[model samples]
Target: MMKRVTLGLFGAWLLHDAEEWFTLAPFSARKAASGGGQVGLPWMRREISEAHAHTAVALVGVVIAAASARGYRTEGRSRFYQAALAGFGLHGFSHLGMTVAERGYTPGVVTAPIVVLPFGYYAHRELARTGVARPGLRTALEGIAVAGGALAASHALAGMLHPATSAATP
Candidate 1:
């Protein structure tokens, strides 16, 4: 059950991120084209190129895969795996909130409710059932912070790898 649950995290993340990867580029393009980019918070106003967006998603995938691997090897005993699972579960809420804030469909919003939340809940339940120790609130929060920081770093790396270009000449 632990093995299945651990592996399930990777599979579910793949599905959720696949949705994000495909939609993000197009969505950002549409927003930029419509001048919707200018109407949001400073962070939202920055538009990411398709390459950068996809690369960031891929980078996160690597992190998820590593966590899943560690969980599988440790048979759910690893604190890192426990924290990651808890963090991933809670991360789904961010997607829902993003959709609400945007007042429209957002990437990963669909899968957050269906795939991410359900898998996270099921995985956590199975972990508890198997007598694996919970990561505790502090570890869970740390996991979330790590995940968020990793995402930001991935985006920065992606940007460096594929810097956004402009048609206008200086």
Candidate 2:
């Protein structure tokens, strides 16, 4: 049951990320400044190149898939899973903050409420349902670090690559 639930969250995250890569990145690219960059968190910034956005999405997908495939029922595994839930929950809020900060739409905002919320809720609920201990602050911090690093790396890598698409394309 824990395995299934964890896998489900991973699947949803993959889909949510797809929305960002396919829809959000391309859409936001048009609005990004031509000469100057915007300010925000590394991953949640307004000027992320499309290549990096897609790369980041793909990397996260790989991580989630690997985590699901490996196993998530043990004590350490449960801690990571719980932490993932909390981290993802925080990620969702980050998107909301991005939206508010920009005073407009932002990449990942569309799916944040839809995909992130339910998955986080169910992931946490399923973990609790299965008797997994809620992660402590340390575990939560670890989760945040892992997720933040993965996402920030993706953004950095995207900047290194060529643009995935032109701003003219719809």
**Which regions of candidate 1 are displaced past 4 Å?**
37-44, 165-170
Q: What's the lDDT for residue 72 in model 1?
A: 95
TM-score for each of the candidates: 0.89, 0.78
Clashing pairs in 1: none
TM-score of candidate 2 on Cα atoms, chains taken together: 0.78
What local distance difference test score does each model get?
A: 0.78, 0.65
- Candidate 1 accuracy as lDDT: 0.78
lDDT measured at residue 64 in model 2 versus the true structure, 0 to 100: 65
For candidate 1, the TM-score is: 0.89
